[model samples]
Target chain A: MVAKTRGMKIVHSIEVLQHMLNRDERIGRTVGFVPTMGFLHEGHLALVEQARTQNDLVVMSIFVNPAQFGPGEDFEAYPRDIERDSRLAAEAGVDVLFMPTPEEMYPQDGGIRILPGPQATALCGASRPGHFDGVLKVILKLFNIVDPDRAYFGMKDAQQLAIIETFVRDYNLRTAIVRVPTVREPDGLAKSSRNVNLSEKEREEAPVIQQALQKGAALFHTGASAEQVEKEVAQYITEHSSGRIDYVSLLAYPELTTSSETSREWILACAVKFEKTRLIDNSILSVFSKEFPTQ
Target chain B: MVAKTRGMKIVHSIEVLQHMLNRDERIGRTVGFVPTMGFLHEGHLALVEQARTQNDLVVMSIFVNPAQFGPGEDFEAYPRDIERDSRLAAEAGVDVLFMPTPEEMYPQDGGIRILPGPQATALCGASRPGHFDGVLKVILKLFNIVDPDRAYFGMKDAQQLAIIETFVRDYNLRTAIVRVPTVREPDGLAKSSRNVNLSEKEREEAPVIQQALQKGAALFHTGASAEQVEKEVAQYITEHSSGRIDYVSLLAYPELTTSSETSREWILACAVKFEKTRLIDNSILSVFSKEFPTQ
Candidate 1:
């Protein structure tokens, strides 16, 4: 009963989650989900808040899935603070916190592949081999566990967002996928739990990543071609920032295809390495030709 | 209303399936799913029968997924008779026959990869690059689509069944996975629709594939080592059978690992190519020793 008011329920097992979810005899209660690898940040909170505002019950999962991490890719170093995450989640008005341990999540002899398609091969997909697979797999597991009416993801990982969208469409998952705008700091640095790992200097240089993306967006708005936009952004970041540019490309929005002729809306997405930490950000640019005749 | 009696519902979209499932509000309606590439045969029917007996609803999907087949493989020539499949499904008491097209399954921008683990790298996985990935992708899609309470798979495709079981466990999917015994013909040939394409001599020699597996099982029954059993079976198939011996080995049941000593329970599995048609089969052997101690 106390859980109903605060909308709080903590479920670790898939069976228990399904059992509790079945209590909703009527379809009136809309379930919202926010899946994270714990070590929650303001960006995660933004997603939770969005879910809380839109849905009746919010389920947040804190799982640092190993499958998504490639060999020697910081599976162990990936931050986890469940007590703090739970407190933050409760404050964010999450109805349930589905925190399952790695063993609980992936039982012995467990093997399932949730491969995100071609969208996986590009962007982060190219950087991390099994990363998107892990992302899709864990999210899918959570999706089944929560069976949320709506699921929220951040645009901070724009390609991840795009891949998830493709998965939902391809699998025809029942959950309504909602993409909330990327949450950022006052300095325009994209909010990430990973930001905590950054030193003062790295944190200071982080905003430059956002600035480069913004500049790219501005260039696209000024009638620059995609190649020109990418080159300018890449050069600016290389000169003005200490971060190593992983990739800088202008792609068709949602589709994520690289094209120079910007006849339609597109996204300028990129990932940069500040120290050993990798940070990603993106901004959408709606391209329109000024010479178009009125229909 | 008519579909309800048969435990069948015509859900036009994934949204509708979720909406109706949401209304059920009870976790008791255990669903048993049978995913197929259509062109249903008795081998498939056996799985359906097992599902019907065990679960509340039997949902079968008819999809010839392109992702699972190799470039020069039988993707184009893969047998598909949907109209006939539907009628057979209805006769099998299938609650819902999910018929999704390639476009329906994979969106224009979709990138899916459901890779099976190391076990996938052996046997069929080694032969077909990205085959298990495609198989996994479609299976994951089906799992999301049906959200079944239980899923039934045939042991005829022993490696596939093993990989799927691995996926379900690894992902912590809630569906109760039930594997049915492999169905075979009177002559010990594994029932496969591909058998239709076999020439008369090839069809007659096909039973030798199963015979070879049985020989291994018999060797285990006679207290032979796994290595000896595997060697004998491989030799028997190679020497006697007209088909090209793809693989013949004695493995631990469920685990699919090669063992030196024979245990009470082991699987004798093999794959053989009789011309263009590939046949696979396995039999479980229960080994007993005269010096065994009582529990």
Candidate 2:
């Protein structure tokens, strides 16, 4: 165990993390986990803050998962800064920061896979095929190793959160998934490590994602169809930003399914790709309410 | 919790089982798990006995997994004797018998899957496409639910055991996988619930599987190649039994790879198909040894 600032331990191997967690579990310490790809931002720090409040121990894993990236995707260009991440994690009161190498995490070709259901065919999953499978694969590995009492995910990636929620429930996993509201910049652009990759103009225009999702969600008050909401959101982003629209999806919340007449809750989500970055944002709303739902 | 004979509890719900185990875990009790498709033969009882001896708590789950059975297979006709199983489990000192219904186990279609690697392509896997995938899916669910310190599996399903071992290692699961030797009847037929499907004549001839494995393994003393061992085993079973052969495989142990000159440990395994039943057995041996390896 390597000691960081304020007696925080940084674990780089699975065996070491499990051993430490075993001791914590025996002592009845509730563990809360935050999984990230390093280059910590306010979004990740907010997750850590929530974890710090709920758990006796906070474990944060920073691994840039290769499997989650596709053939031409930015697996290589994904931002990583361990020194800065460690310092921020330490200041945020994380107990253990697990930083495992790709080789350490995936030592051999694992024949086993955790496939996403039809829930994966929309939003970001639609554009990046097999992305959720890779997300689930790494998450399952991290969950098995950490055995957290509760794990934290941001609602910025609403589709990812919904898929993971389904995965935990379907597998009967013990860990409770807590969804933290998305953290955004002063201008309403969702805070992400990739935000650093955005050019000045791209960053200035990125808040259009949140604005469009809110506008699309407001359409439901006029009893608009899901297709209308999607089209409205897509057109708004197209008019506002130089980014290419990956998708504009409005589906039943949590279930990530096409909404029917009886469906009460829905998620209006969108993803936009600029030259060097892809940004996603979402708004969850209940049609019963006249006003747009709170983040 | 439903109380059975001698204060043994039978839990039908995942939530209830987890609740009970949580208390047990808080007090630092070690849990031993034995997952089986129920029919409480000596083989399963032997696994229970081992669990009883090793851990403070013994949990045995008896659910005939529907996923593992291929199309037109005997999933519907598979043996089930819950009353007898419960009685035998209690008598053999099983602490908790988890008998969840198919509905309880599989409440919805789980999007997640655990696929096996190249190791699944030969032996019984050759004939049963998608069999190991199903095996891994259910086992992963059970493992997450039980969270045992040590899980027991019989060597009778050597290929399955090998696949599961790889899964556990590949995933870095905390549970220690305990390999229990195959239990046999006095006639040397490996004990299996499927054995009940055999006719009297088939039952009498099933011992040929073990005999054939032994013969093939002994030929390794003559520096026989894997093909030669496979051929010898296949010929012996054909000559001795009225059953048709499924496969006679000679592969590296645990790794389950096709053996080469550098391979020291080998698994000589075979499956025989009768009119109604398919029986599998294997013997693990070291080529460096002059005599056949023990069961």
Query: Considering summed lDDT, which 10 consecutive residues are worst modelled in model 1 chain A?
Result: A286-295
lDDT of 2 at B131: 93
**Candidates' DockQ values?**
0.44, 0.61
Evaluate residue B3 in candidate 1 and report its C-alpha lDDT on the 0 to 100 scale: 39
Q: How high is the CA lDDT of each candidate model? A: 0.75, 0.86
Q: After superposition, how far is residue A276 of candidate 2 from its true place, in Å?
A: 1.1
Q: lDDT score, residue B190, model 1?
A: 79
Write candidate 1's Cα lDDT for B87-188 as tens digits: 788888887777666876675545565667676766666678788888877787778777787788887887888788877776666677787887888988
Q: Which stretches of candidate 1 lie over 4 Å from their true place?
A: A1-7, A11-15, A22-28, A66-81, A109-129, A201-205, A234-244, A260-263, A275-278, A289-295, B1-28, B75-84, B107-109, B234-241, B260-264, B287-295
* Candidate maximizing lDDT: 2
Best by DockQ: 2
What digit string (tens of lDDT, one per residue) describes model 2 on residues A148-189?
889999999888898999888888877899999999889888
Q: Estimate each model's TM-score.
A: 0.85, 0.95
